[model samples]
Target chain A: MEEFEPKIVAFCCHYCAYSAADLAGSMRLQYPPNIRIVEMPCSGTIDHRVILDAFEKGADGVYVAGCMEGDCHFLKGNYRAKKRVNYVKKVLAEIGLESERLEFFNLSAAMGPRFAEIANEMTERIKKLGPSPLRRKGEEK
Target chain B: MIVAQQKPLEEIARLINDCQKVLLVGCAGCVTVCLAGGEKETEFLASALRIKRQLEGNPLETVTFTCTRQCDPEYLLPLDNLIGDVDAVVSLACGVGVQYIAERYPHKWVVPALDTKFAGGSLEQGVWAERCGLCGNCILHLTGGICPVIRCSKSILNGPCGGSQDGKCEIARDVDCAWQLIYDRMKALGKLERLMEIMPPKDWSTARDGGPRRAVREDVIIDA
Candidate 1:
C-alpha cells in the first residue's frame, strides 16, 4: 500500500513565489504533486481564514511563499504576511493543531530551484508528521 | 486603542461546544479598528465553526452581527432578538465588550473570541506596540509623550538605568531604551530643564490598587 500523502496548499504571492513555481515547472524540477498552488496578489492579502480553512478542508499542510524581505512589490506586504503567519502559528498551537503545519517562506522570483527544494522539504516534513488532525471527517485515517 | 487578537479557531469552537445556534458578535469600535473583532472576522469565525461542526457530524447555525460598540448597552440592544434564539454568543470584542455582553444578558452565555491585550498603537501598518499603561494617571507631559510606565519594560519612572547600552534596553536586547527616547524628545523641544525635576514614585493606590476605580460627575448626571 502506498504511504498516505499529505495534501499541502501553497499560498504564493503573484510577484515572486508564483513565478518561481512556474519557473520550477519549466525547468522540469521534480516536486510533490500533492501540493496545490493558490496565487494571491500579495502574501499579505492571504487572510488568516485561508490557513484555517485549508486545515478545515482536509489539507495536511499549508505554506505561504512571498518575496524576499525588503523586496515586496507592495512595500511591506511581505512583512505583514510574516506577522500574520506568526500570529496564525500561535493560534494553531493554542487550538490543539500542530503549528508546524503552517509555514512562511521568502525567495526571489528567479529562485525556481528553491521552490522545488521547499516543495520537497515541506512534503517530507508533513509525511513524517502524518496527516493533519483537523482533516475533514472521513479524510482522516 | 485596546489591541487584541482572536483566539485559536478550534479553541473558540470548543468554547461554544454543544451550542447548535451561535451568535457571533463583533465590535466595530476598538476591536474592529485593530482587526481583532470585526464583521470580516466574524464571518471568518462563523464559517470556520460551521466547517468544524459539519465535520464532527453536529450541525450548527451561526448568525453574525456587528455592533457599533459591544461595550455599550445601546449597541447591545440590537442583539436582543438574536440572543433569545441562539445557544450562545461569541463576542469578538475586547475584555470590556465581553463583560458588557455578560452583564447585559446575565442569563446568556457570552464567550470571548479574542485576548484583550493593552492600550497601544500600531508600530506600523499591522504591528502593535504598547504605548500607554493607563495607570489612571497622565504623565506624558513630563516624559515627552514617551510613556515610561508602559514602554519602559520595567515601568521605571527614572530609567535608562546603568543597564542601558547603545540605546538598547538592558532587560531586553530588542527593545529600545524608552527613557532615552523621552530624554531626546524633551531635549529636542528645548525642555531639557524639565528632566532635572524629580518625579515622585508613582502611587499604586490610585490605580487598580484602589479596588475597582470609579468616576462620577454631578454635572453629567441627569435625574428624573
Candidate 2:
C-alpha cells in the first residue's frame, strides 16, 4: 500500500501569512510539500462557500492563516476571519466533517519558522485523519 | 420584521434526500433582513446540500433562485419554468414562503429550510431580539412604547409580576422585566398617573385565539 499524502489548502493573507510563507521559502526552512497555499488580500475575504467548496472539490484539510489579533492591516480583518473560520468549523462538524480538519492561525510576516511549522503541523494532522469522506473512490491520495 | 433561522444542514439534507434535483427558493422579504433567507444564503445552502449528497454517493442537483417576496403570489410565478424538472423544493424563506411554493406547485414536494422565529428587529449584526406578539392590536401607545405582551416573560399586561428585580425578569438575568421598562418609560413621560387606573383584562379574541385572521381592503381589489 502506498503512503497516503493528504491534500491541504492554506488561505494565506498577503500582509501576514503569505509574506511569512515567502520568508520561510527564503530562509530555506524545511516543511512538508503536502499543502497548497492560496494568497488573499486579507484573510477577512475568506468566505464560507469557498472554504466548503475546497472540501467539496477534494481538499483533505484547510486552514486560514492571518495576522495576529489586533494586528490586521485593515484594522479588524483578522478578527473577522477568525469568527468566520470558527463558524465554518461548526458547519463542517454538523456535516460530519471533523472540525479539527479546519483551523485558523495568527502570525506576523517575520515568523518564517512558524510558517513552516504550521505547514508540517497541518500535514501530520490530515495524514492521521486519512482521506476526506467526500473524496470519490479510486482517486489520488 | 419577521426573524427566522436556517435549519441545520443535516435536517435539510434529509428533507430532499430521496430527490436527485431540487429548487432552493429564497425570499427577499423579512427573511432577507433577518439574514436567514436571501440570494447569498440560498446559494450557500444549495452548495452545502450538494456536498452532503455527493458524499452520500447519491449526487444531488440543485437550482437556487431568490424571489422578491415568496409570501406573495406574483413573486413565485417566475418559478413556473424552473419547477418543471425539480423533484422537490426547499424553501429558505419563512413558513409563509414554504406554503406559497407548495400551493403554487401542487404536484411537487416542498420543504422549509428555515424555522420562522419571531416578529423582531435586529439588535446588531448576527443578533435579533423579539419585539412584537402579533396580537392584531396596537397597545404600545399606553405602555410608553414598551410592550409587555411580548417582552414580558409571562406576557403580564399590568405587572411587575413580583418576579421583576433590578429591572430584570425572573426568567433570566438578561431578560428585562417588561413592566419595569414600561414603568421607567411611563415615569419619564410624566404618565405615572396612567398606571394607577385599574386596567381591565385584554380581549383574547383579537389574538391567535381568534383563529387565522385576514384583512380585506376592498379599495385595492380589481375584479378580473
Candidate 3:
C-alpha cells in the first residue's frame, strides 16, 4: 500500500484570500503544497456546481477562502459564500463523502499567518481522511 | 408560476441507482425562476449522482438537457434524439415535467427530482408563497387581491374565521390572516362598503369539484 497523497482544491477570493496567499508567500510562511488555489473575484461567486465539480474531478478535499465577517469587498460576498458552502456540505454528505472534506474560511488580506494556519489545518484534515472515495484504485498517489 | 423544490440528493440517487446511464432534464420555466430546476442545477445533479455511484464502485453515465418548457409538446420535441439508450430519466422540473416525460417516452423510466409546491410567486430571493388556488374562477376583484381561498388555512370564502388573531392566523403565528390583508387593502381603497354585501356560497362546480378540467380556444386550433 503506497502513501495516500490527497488532492485539495481551494477556491480563494481575489479581494482577501488571494491577497492573503500572496502575503503568506512574502512572509515565508510554510504550508502544505497539496492545495491548488483557484482565484475568484468574490467568494459570493462560488457556485455549488463548481464545488461539486471539484469532487467529481477527484479532489480529495475542497475549501473556499473568503473575507471575514462584515468585511467582504462586495458588502456580503463572504456571507453569501458561507451559505453556499453550508449547502454543498449537505450534498457532499449525500454523495458518500465526509462533509468535513469541504470547508469555508474567513480571513483578511493582512492575515498572512492566519492564511498559513488555514492551509495547514485543511491539509491535516484531508491527510487524516486520506484520498476521496471517488479516487480510482491506482490514482490515490 | 408553478413553484417547486428539489428532493434530497439521496432519494433521487436511490430512484435511479439501478440504471447504468440516465438523462437529467431541466426546465427553463417556473422551476428555473424558483431556483429549483435549471441548466446549472441539472449539471450539478448529474455530477452529484455520478460521484455517488463512483464512490460505490459503480460508475454512472449522465446526459443533461434543458427544455424551454416541459409541459408544452413542442418544447419537448428536441429530446427525441437525446433520450436514446438511457436506462432512465431524472427530471428536475416540477411534477408536470416528470409526467410529461413519462408520457412522451413510455418505454423508459422517468423520475421527478422536484416536489411541485404551488402556483405562486416569489416572496423574496429564495422564498415563495402561494397566491392563487387555480379554482377556475376570478375572485380577486372581490377580495381586494388577497386570496382567502389559498392564503387562509380554512379556505373561508366570506369572512375571517375565529382563528384570526392580531392579524395572524391561529394555526400558526407566522401565518398572516388573509382576511386581515383583505380588510386593510379594501379600507385603504375606500371599498369597505363592498364588504357589507352578504356574499352567497360559492358555486363549487367551477372548482376541482367538477373533475379534471381543460381549456381550449377554437380559434387557435391548427389542422394536423
Clashing pairs in 1: none
Which candidate do you rate higher for lDDT, 1 or 3? 3
lDDT-best of 1 and 2: 2
lDDT of 3 by residue, A93-136 (tens): 87888999999999999999999999999999999988887887
Q: Write model 1 residue lDDT over A34-139, tens digit each, in one string.
A: 8899999999898887788788778889999999999999989999989889987876765556789889999989999999999999999999998776665465
Q: Which stretches of candidate 3 lie over 4 Å from their true place?
A: none
The DockQ-based CAPRI class assigned to model 1 is incorrect
For all candidates in order, the CA lDDT equals 0.87, 0.91, 0.91
What are the clash counts of all predictions, listed in order? 0, 0, 0
- Give TM-score, chain B, model 3: 0.98
Sort by TM-score, best first: what order? Answer: 3, 2, 1
Each prediction's TM-score versus the true structure = 0.68, 0.93, 0.97
Cα displacement (angstroms), candidate 3, residue B136, comes to: 0.6
**What does TM-score give for chain A of every model?**
0.95, 0.98, 0.96
Distance (Å) between predicted and true CA of B189, model 1?
A: 2.5
Chain A, model 3: TM: 0.96
Candidate 1 deviant stretches above 4 angstroms:
A1-141
